[model samples]
Target chain A: MIVIELSERQLKIIEIVKENEPITSEQIAQFLKVTRATLRPDLAILTMSGMLDARPKVGYLYSGNNTVSIISEHVKRTKVSEIKSMPVVVDEQTTLYDALVSLFLEDVGSIYVLSHGYLAGVISRKDFLKNIMGGTDIHKMPVGLIMTRMPNIVTTYPHETALEAAIKIIEHEVDSLPVVEKFEEKGKEYFKVVGKVSKTNITRLFVELGRQK
Target chain B: MIVIELSERQLKIIEIVKENEPITSEQIAQFLKVTRATLRPDLAILTMSGMLDARPKVGYLYSGNNTVSIISEHVKRTKVSEIKSMPVVVDEQTTLYDALVSLFLEDVGSIYVLSHGYLAGVISRKDFLKNIMGGTDIHKMPVGLIMTRMPNIVTTYPHETALEAAIKIIEHEVDSLPVVEKFEEKGKEYFKVVGKVSKTNITRLFVELGRQK
Candidate 1:
């Protein structure tokens, strides 16, 4: 947690130490703008802060400390395979209870809604939760009303890097991105929901990578 | 845990239903090289096995089922941001115990060894475990001998996609790849270890995307 306040003299000292650590005070004072007496106090402070190393003959050296924050350091760059849950989907006309069971049993954050075998809408846990709480008939309602509609869907390539995807998650403020595979059927285009990614998946990755250490 | 044993008739039924799900069994039977009675049995078995859905009159459709494995599915994808740990690392001269402490405390899968401010080698948790079982002096042994050294140390660019890296991991049969950013120091070359990518990260990405459903 040492935040080094750079002074002109300290910066010079840093440069000198950077060149060759274990340098003597006399040589530093003679070559630099500051006096050895003036430099002594700075040296002592830097050394004490663990930012600098001190020696009897050689004056000092930067501790060579370069550290990222603990949380960021342990961050794992996931692959599509790691975060993608197998698809849990239903027709736009399926009963709410059926969708709820799929979401619950799969333990997924969201579910894809298909229409005649086409990517249609995404139904999230929040959507289902809100519906269940609103006293709606579980068997009567279809997911199409509450589901996020198409063209709004965020997706990733089966071959994309997780770090890039992480950036997308942060920037877009979206919790997950579906992994999709394109197929041609009956001479037409269709997007098959193959897998899914969630924020928890990102957290789990760090957990696993962190466990390695 | 139902493994759909495919017969030629069953495969034909699947292909037809897969292309046009919610299409009636009569239609599938018409399209396939089979009779309606034969298709009815396949449809019944598929639905019972959680592979298809049967509506009274609308016909039979693949349920998008059984693709999600309950066992592997729970190992959720997580962001790299949540874990609290320093980057797992050590100098070339550091004893195996020094690396082990970082490994155990952080619970990470791998540790990188640095020398002259450059990555020299990587030691995986598996490596450490195997070595310990082989009766090596963890306290006395320097990791230089056991580490996967330079050139053998596979790397990835920070900008590369997670999907690409995952394929690389499978291709290389390595546990992880150091995310590398290259630069010149004193007109010479060096690589800064920016981050790391592993299988867990890939899995986490999938989880994150799935949750957004």
Candidate 2:
């Protein structure tokens, strides 16, 4: 099980409560311009989470004790280099059949496309799956032809934390991110493939932290 | 940005430091069976996140003041009914092509497979993409033939919080979940599909909660 954080509506309720201390549920409803019944879930969540304490006729009061919440600080201070694992690399010229075999053999969700030891593109399960499902001649097609190329690829650095990595994963809707390091190669900026991070990495952190006191 | 939680390694380090107050970084590295250089990143993370305070000669101290951690409780208290959205449903008899059309038209990642208004299975983009890529006749094939069937399906109750839903999503490696409520149908147990929840919903909650004090 994971921890549930305050929802968007709950945050709004708290903000309103902070501005109007000891506010009644009805008053909060009015501020939000919604019915009292509609706010019941939000109120219940806030109260149960200890962000607000309520009493009959006393109204909702901001408990405000959750100062220094762990996650926010953890995200800010974590650099990408901390949790990244070595990337699964594949050459762009590799045939789709070879790439597919590599993907399953390595049991990795994605493989980074490398050209002469620099990041070039990425191919994932979906990419290969899509091609195979489409009846492409896997043995003849180069993986690079269908790979999501650079500049469009989302990447993170070792100096960034897993939190930033998670956001990129969610935002880009990709299963993994190539953790890269920047360098100037022949007067052109290039990101050298270094490591990778995925949604699993972030979720694992959540589970671990929740287990702590 | 998403809220960052401590990784298992970081948590273990904190536990060690807590048990051995004013412990040196060298002592931590020794206990973890790694060289001091290897532990530098973890130590930097802990210190920067305020979980630890280090002094030149004093070693490390557990600063442990994350009193308002949101996840553990929030996950336990919030129910699936609170965050679920209307499920995208399709009949088992629907052709793969039709189902694929519905999935894209609805702009949803997954579709619930319903047999006579009771959920029988689930089909997702991966499923469709896989089938189409495999050279299957989408027009002739029924979605039910290839869908992940019941009992094997991971589901959640409306009364369960989003935290459980999130964990199920991660553990099962599914993009979304069908929120369900159990009912007795002719002396047999059946789960009535009520709504749906996705990873996006969970991450959105985290972002909103983190933005609050």
Candidate 3:
């Protein structure tokens, strides 16, 4: 994809077209005080970019589609697998205290809880804090007790676009998402935690995109 | 800015220029079996976007800078004030338990602590979790005792770019930043918290950019 900053003359041409629809190219050239040959390339760029509509035996009309759709195309092309980070996981039997320890050690916002080596639930700092505030015995209670159980939890896969993952996070009001791989056994569906995509990952990608040359 | 997907002919023209440096327009047209008139707009686009360089009496040369710098430009132009959300602020004397209550009520990741109507400290869920794990008296201890203090807190202004704020969050490993306005009192610098910018904001902006038309 090629992104070009429209030249002054081209912007002017667009303004002129917006004011005078169905105007011929010769008329535009006359308004701009330039030769038809000189305006050919500018007209080509405007028409090709879908900012203007050129009709045979008629004239040019403003298409009113001059915004950046290409930017979205670039963002959607990035897949989840390319930017996911290592997930912090603990078994369902682990104590809430132990899970909190893992959270601090890993410096992550949330932890994935596993039961029989498959994702059962997810816990986060907020959950631990609320349980602590409620005076729950962290040492005796397993993380699975207070965790947000699966099937209700939002998830993303390797092949999905990062844009899709980000959308899920925002719409669901969650800080992180577990990137999982699905499995089927005895007519039951299960997901294995593979990676994690959080607001941190999306923010990092935004910074990277901003710094791209 | 106008973003366009380059036509097949324009891309072909670039490939030919890359292979043959200082190639004339006439030579390129010959390679593509098209007249110079047909190739004029393609060459204009290639050269104007800085993907190919043209020199007087020297023809066109591959500039090797075909990547999306425009995307970064677009991102940097967005200011922090345009996207900042209402900050969750509490007095330094407020109990940690009360502060946590405010956090839950506002549904914010961090809370800004104010002293004499100016920013004095900042606290996040991780900080509260850590203190709780260490057995701090949330109901008795004031938030000032454990909050990250001012001058150490990273901040952004209304005029600063969102890109700068995102960079600070990544580098400092903080969840959020207080959008502050500076004050001077008796040669002492003070900051009043006006808003908040977090990874959530950056992620939202990313989604918006992706959804831009």
Candidate 4:
């Protein structure tokens, strides 16, 4: 039987919850750029399916299968224990020509810009292309000047479901996400760097997993 | 900057013929499928790199820009064209227990077994699961004797990419290939039940196509 029974629209709602639960329906309507009337039925289906646990104060939260929930929680607790690579972040300060070559050679869509080993900004191929295509002096311009900064981005722990990873790709319409090593109190890792989950990799990984069945 | 392009066995060649030319070494040992050294190199690297042309007595192939030839002749021409859906067909003889409870209610995997209008065989969660779990009951049973019958299975048109449809679940793996309606010899609308691709969808189709900066 299909376990997670949610339509595309309903799933969108669940995803919004992922971004931040205990969020109100009004905020959901505003966040998705959809109307409450349209959101109502979608919410109804999710609620009916018992995929969301509702409450008087807390808005909507995902109520996945016990197995999935337990797995997600355990993984969340671990986050990234240690970063393998010393984050060589690419920011607006990074040159366009350098960024292009780095991304291609590394086979990564993005490079994080770290200031003192902290995520300062992020630059992607799409961003680099747009600017370079505009006849800008890519070789001279630092990437930091053209990178996407914090808050506008989304990140997940190493323990999160690759399912969650897949959803992030679809929901945000991005090619890859930076896998970070979140620290507890005094920032042991400073989120140096770990790995990335690209949309293409996500699709291929799931297909391989399915085949084991 | 990438230095080692060839794999381990590829490094032990006796002679350095071509840098990256497509040679028909298969003539020497193509069918053997033992080692890369079996096939000979095309006249080493002739006036290639956009210059050479194929000719007899010239090793195997011209070391020219075969990339363009590959794109224009092979890659572009071999495409999945004109997709149409097959009617959900299953046998009426199938136990309602499978259809209503398994395929419909429980949303078991979809299956189809057709033979000249008289649909036979079946595809479903139980069919595949039982097969995987070592349930012998399915092997002895006939889908026609237990299928959901016509207007039950799902098929597609000719223009659609089978890979596209296969990736819809983004999770579920399919065993029985879907039947697509495409042209036959006489540009006929009737489907000839063309060749099948697999759950791997592994044409190794992963790279995103777009202009690079």
Please tell me which predicted candidate would have the highest lDDT against the true structure: 3
lDDT of 3 by residue, A1-213 (tens): 777788899999999999999999999999999999999999999998899999998999999886656473567688999999999999988999999999999999999998988889999888898898899999999998899998889999999999899999999999999999999999999999999999999999988888776
Candidate ranking under lDDT, highest first, comes to 3, 2, 1, 4
- Local accuracy of candidate 1 as per-residue lDDT tens digits, A66-168: 2211222113334667666677888999877788767657756578899887788888654554454355666788888778887788877667766556656
Better of 1 and 3 by lDDT: 3
> Candidate 2 residues B43-123, lDDT tens each?
765664456899888999988765434344544455678777788898989998788767656767789999888989999
TM-score pick, better of 2 and 4? 2
Worst ten in a row by lDDT for model 4 chain A? A66-75
The CAPRI class of candidate 1 is incorrect
Worst 10 residues of 3 chain A by lDDT: A66-75
Best by TM-score: 3
Candidate 1 second chain TM: 0.58
TM-score of 4: 0.34
TM-score rank, highest first? Answer: 3, 2, 1, 4
Candidate 2: residue B115 Cα off by (Å): 0.6
Task: Write one digit per residue (lDDT tens) for candidate 4, span A9-116.
Answer: 666778887778878888999988887765765665455445676776878877762122111112222222222223345645667677766765665557777766
Candidate 1 TM-score to native: 0.36
